[model samples]
Target: MTKTTTRPLAELQADFVRVGALLKQAREDVETLRRLSMAEAQAETLAAELEAIKRQMDRAFADEDKAKEDAFIAGIKDVRITEGDQRDNLIRRTFTVAVTRTGNDGLRDWETTAEKTGLTSLKPEEYAWLLRHPDRIPASILALADDPRTAFQTYFSSKKRGYFRGA
Candidate 1:
């Protein structure tokens, strides 16, 4: 024979309500966790996309800068002159002169007109000495300096504008 213990209906009903509330709270917590996980995933994806866009922008800026540099280099004329002494096989000299126009009055004035013949590398005293004794300079180099083409017919013919007006 078994003996059964029974509680009041009100008490049992209150216990059921409490269990139901706990179940609901557990479900809400699970839903919150799911939302948090989804948000973290979305943030990761957005961060990757932002990084990709930044890389593309960086590459674009680099390309633009390279193009500008190439254009500027193209504007300068590089003239190469080689001189060799027949008497001595080892005596050979090469000079590369970079010429460009100057002043705001078109290409009428040219900077480095005489100094562009590789003489700009000399010290002030050495240049003054050369000025006093021009015969020390090679005849071919002097002839090149005397050429009209070396004066006004080189590259960078346009006058500087905007930020480079005085510079």
Candidate 2:
């Protein structure tokens, strides 16, 4: 089994504060080095070092935000708003997923194949007629339309959205 240790919230906050100070000092150092008349090779080395530190700082901030989001998600479930002030800025945690088509079967020229398969043969008039007469629409299509999950899989994508706002 893997061993685990938990630190107090105070310690976590202290660690972040120390990291912030280190990032501030590293930035100052980079600015000071920029002011100096250094050789090209030396300047490149310093710039690379600064860039690495900046990446680390970015990761640190991202991790911190993730932790905050996790905590907020856990805490928000216990709270509710029956009635409250409208001016307060409500904060919330959100998650999203992205999907991209990965098949590489020369799909760029699929229109011709689709048309030949009668997939794209339906015209605006046919669609309007279908809408006017739902009974004519296929049972499968009607069933899928009634089911959000199936309809989402067939028509929508993997993109997700969420936001925090006043009620």
TM-score of 2: 0.25
Q: How many clashing pairs in candidate 1? A: 0
Q: Please report, as a residue range, the 10-residue window in candidate 2 with the lowest summed lDDT.
A: 110-119
lDDT of 2 by residue, 43-101 (tens): 89989999999999999999997676554333121111121232432212121211111
Candidate with best lDDT? 1
- Per-prediction count of colliding residue pairs? 0, 0
Give each model a TM-score.
0.34, 0.25
lDDT of 1 by residue, 1-167 (tens): 89778998999999999999999999999999998989988999999999999999999999997676554444233233334543532112334333332343574744443234333354443433333344555454444345433422121121112121122
- How does residue 122 of candidate 1 score in lDDT? 44
Q: List candidate 2 segments past 4 Å from native.
A: 1-38, 75-167
Q: Which candidate is the best by TM-score?
A: 1
* Whole-model Cα lDDT of every candidate shown, in order: 0.51, 0.45
